[model samples]
Target: MFEVEVKYRVPNHDAIRDRLKALNAKFLEHTEETDIYLNSPLRDFAKTDEALRVRVYGDGTVVLTYKGPRIGNVGKTREELSVTANDLDSLLEILRRLDFREVAKVVKRRDIYNYENFTIYLDTVEDLGSFVEVETMVNDKELINRATDEVLQFGDKLGLKREWIEKRTYLELVLERGNERR
Candidate 1:
């Protein structure tokens, strides 16, 4: 699976949300996510087109997403990856193990998402600004190049960057900024 995403420097998030509503779309749920970006001893991500992610924790609790199908805060998405071990009840039981800094459910929407396959997903986040994603299920070098190029195009169109992209999770973003003020 592959993920192609870009974070835009939103001017007026509320205004964007309002405009999205006029288009007959909505976010899914606001989920506060805590991510641990690992270090790869092998390659330079700055120039690479592919990334590998493994479900270390919350394997059963959270649905792992590979393809993001959403444009704008109103964009929709479909789960490209779902990790279910035994049963829903048993799954929920395992979710109880990992520690999360913050968990905000996404506010879903009904718009459009395009990738190797078409899918619709939801997104509603808090203290992290409005964002969208697009992923594809391809790992080949050629495919990764294509997908990464596509994502970069969107990022360029939106005037985003690999730098401005928040490397830290939202919970960390909040805390990092808060600590900066002190």
Candidate 2:
């Protein structure tokens, strides 16, 4: 599937949560996520704008995801393939044996909400402060552009300003912060 989303840096989630309540958005579960990012030995995923991740949720569920390079200039649109993993240690061992090296670990608490056709994610990232992500998934590649527009429009409807929109991924932000500190 293609994941079409836009992320915004916000001071806090209070305003967005109120707006979501006003819109009668359905509240989903709140969960903490630990994402482990890996790098391929053969290529530089950072240069290619691709990602491989192992996500362990607070409920003990584990997921393996491969995200392709970003497709368009409008939004953070990409082809995402994901599957559930039964064993996190075994999966990490397999990836390590295959020469995939761990690059970064990101932890965040996420509150999910559903309004209309969009899944809204309110995230409080470790060390990175708060963010809101508006996202939708589409199976057809042709629908990506339209989906991107809709995601942005939905964010605007929720009082998210375009100026606050952030195109960088959490991992990128973390890496940049590390570089700045060094």
Candidate 3:
């Protein structure tokens, strides 16, 4: 499915949470997530703008996700394929044997909300601070444009300013920040 999403850097997460409640958004789940992003030895994911990661959530659920390059100029719209994994260790081992190296790990506390067609994430990311992501899944490629527009509009309804929108993933942002400190 296509994951049409938009993220924003916000100063106060509590304010946004209140706004979501005001809009009648449903509280989903609060989870601590650690995402381990891997780099394929054959292709440079950094140059290609693709991602493969294993996310382990607080409730002990594990998910493996592959994210394709971003599409369009407006938001972080992309093709995302994900599945639940029964064994995180085995999956990591398989990736390692396949020459995929661990690139970065992002730790975050996420509060999820459901509002209409969107799954909203209020994330407190370690080293990067607070942000919100609104996303929806689309089955058809033709629906990406309309879905992107709708997601951005929903973000605006949550009081997210256009200028505050961030297109870079947390992994990219963290890697860039690390390089800058060198």
* Candidate 1 error regions (>4 Å): 13-81, 85-92, 95-112, 115-124, 157-164, 171-182
* Per-residue alpha-carbon lDDT of candidate 2 for residues 64-123, written as tens digits (9 for 90 to 100): 999999999867898999999999999999999999999999999999999988999999
lDDT of 1 by residue, 47-140 (tens): 3422222222233343333323332321121224544334544433433444211222322222243333322222344544554443344544
> Clashing residue pairs in candidate 3, if any?
none
Better of 1 and 2 by lDDT: 2
Ranking by TM-score: 2, 3, 1
Whole-model lDDT, model 1: 0.38
Per-model root-mean-square deviation over C-alphas: 9.0, 0.7, 1.0
Cα TM-score of candidate 3:
0.96
> What lDDT would each prediction earn against the true structure?
0.38, 0.95, 0.92
- Candidate maximizing lDDT: 2
Highest TM-score against the true fold, candidate: 2
Which residue pairs collide in model 2, if any? none
Each candidate structure's count of clashing pairs: 26, 0, 0
Better candidate by TM-score, 2 or 3: 2
